[model samples]
Target: MEGFPTVELSGRKQHHCAPLCLLHFGPEGKMMPIAIQVQKCKLRCSAELTELLLRRLSQTPGPDCPIFLPSDSEWDWLLAKTWVRYAEFYSHEAIAHLLETHLIAEAFCLAMLRNLPMCHPLYKLLIPHTRYTVQINSIGRAVLLNEGGLSAKGMSLGVEGFAGVMVRALSELTYDSLYLPNDFVDRGVQDLPGYYYRDDSLAVWNALERYVTEMITYYYPCDAAVEGDPELQSWVQEIFKECLLGRESSGFPTCLRTVPELIRYVTIVIYTCSAKHAAVNTGQMEFTAWMPNFPASMRNPPMQAKGLTTLETFMDTLPDVKTTCITLLVLWTLSREPDDRRPLGHFPDIHFVEEAPRRSIEAFRQRLNQISHAIRQRNKCLPIPYYYLDPVLIENSISI
Candidate 1:
């Protein structure tokens, strides 16, 4: 019930509180949450809150822990769940969505511009995916992450705390998990049932790998060829030194050696710029429309008493009308497709003119089209459709 090592999150100074939710399989084998453990630390009524929380459904989590479950007041349980989701919203918006995809892509795009020639195999293969990323990221820094920006207005973690999240995530992050397949294995979610994101990501990653292999092999036929290319080496080293801060702990390569290595690295960047961004960024509007489902901020502190919650209390905890409007407007604007969008593999800039690479592009487009068709057919049968990673819907860059 009591949090420690207090830090600011909700504008006012307080311990960083986040609920631990426990889930399990239901009667029909459906996965549903069983309990939510709430903590109140460094607040005015800590002892009273703990006393009220002592009477709970489960005690294994620890003494004096406020538990929200099915047996509790329905409004109390729902509000608890919403508060938990609010924490996830900050994590998703700050670290997973903005920092992981957009900011990192901008770094890659800058490295490419500075090191690779216009005709370099990697430059041509990747330039299309970096299109408009610079402009979008610049605007995001100004309007979305500025001191009193949308993040401060709508998020529980004001803009300052939001920036802190990004800094911490960047410091602790490594390159190993960015590789999609390794990420699946590392997280032990490779065989997690009905995880459409994992299933579709692997399919798309394999298809992407094939295309990158074709491009890299057409140019650098052997390991010696990869090691000999100065532009390629410079590009990777700059990314390691400048973007990754020359951290040996990061495991980013200073210089690529083999053709397969180059192919795999290129595939990782393209996947992040295209598919990963689409998965995390595109579904904001539909998921957050029902404010309570994905609340951006909480107006009141979390409930301390077990039987004190009511419908009015739950409604009062939600963000004010102004914050709600701003958050929804931003989500709607971002979810809409840009006018000059290029779907994944739909390159129109003609950066690569060689016959072999042109044919590879054609093949890549056909593969993505096939993936789109399969996803559409599968979505037709789903009770709640999730098609964010459909290659046809994914832009070639983090343009929005």
Candidate 2:
């Protein structure tokens, strides 16, 4: 804590000092700075002022080094030197703007990159240039919304930008590029680590697909202004029908042909189940009620209301017929897996309570399995094709 750096900025009538605080332990046990405490400022501190102060402070020998207040002659020279440096560097509009933008972009990209899982190769391959593109794409919706954009319009632009960046990122993934340290590939398939078998890139694509689909379904139906306009409504409907639901649409290239398409579809099932977890958190008990809600006598409900609970109200609120069909098909595909090999771990931040009653937990999993099987049988008569998974490797990639 004492080793941390502090900086003091001086001006005509005031001075401000900020000490960087170590807030959290990062991976590999490195200390990460969480905040800077700035004191006694009349005006808001700009990044330029903070950066200038830091640059000046770093000239000191070490964090333990102390600065003595200047004598009369020394004070005059210091003031003059500071003024000259500010005039030469900070006064230029073009240079200042470029530096500010670069700093903002770089900061955002680095923050995101740091959050990525260390197990994936994509985390290592994520160069600053590519991350900058991802940052732009991630914020494209907010930019559009700032420019008098509608929800549907903003979402469409966001999806388009996200898809473009994703395509470029995915294109970088190859057997050679991913399997680093030639020895990693030389190991037998059985000896290769679980992460190596996991295709993080594909997982990222699956998440992106689910997110985009959910957004489209959520906004396209609710935006009355867009839905009311004939032209806008037509365009929105066309995108929903042709681009998302129709597999034949060339307008929005899914890149499914090049990658394993099974997980892309399977993510819908994962999303549906994951959505229920959110519903539970928000006290939306229409789908499934948390165990805390049940009485002691009825802690174990009937088979119909066992671990998984389904309400007609929630089911009816789902997207249109085509979307629902695809979701069910994905759920069915997932149910076909053996009990132990189910993809429950693929979900984001999901954890089962170890202290929970074993009987109740097993009941819940059984209910989930039953629901998936029932949906599969219900859709068995339809011409819903299955994507084989044995040869298809699953990726564990993430998208912002």
Candidate whose TM-score is highest: 1
Model 1 TM-score (2 dp): 0.89
Q: Estimated TM-score per prediction?
A: 0.89, 0.17
Candidate 2 lDDT by residue in tens digits, 1-400: 0011112111111111222222445565544333222121222245654465446543222333222222224433232223222122211211221112222224323433444343322222222122223443345346422333222121111223223323323323222321223223454333333231123223333443443344333323444533343432233234334323433322322222212222232233233222211211222122112211211011111111111323432222222333333323322332232232223223233232233322333443454444335444544654542211111211121111
lDDT against the true structure, each candidate: 0.80, 0.28
The sequence of per-residue lDDT tens digits that candidate 1 reaches over residues 111-203 is: 999999897878888999998999988987788778767655776666766776677667767888788899888877677777899988888
Candidate 2's displacement at residue 318, Å, is 38
Off by over 4 Å in 2: 1-23, 26-33, 36-259, 272-400
Please give the TM-score that candidate 2 achieves against the real structure.
0.17
How accurate locally is residue 63 in candidate 2, as Cα lDDT from 0 to 100? 35
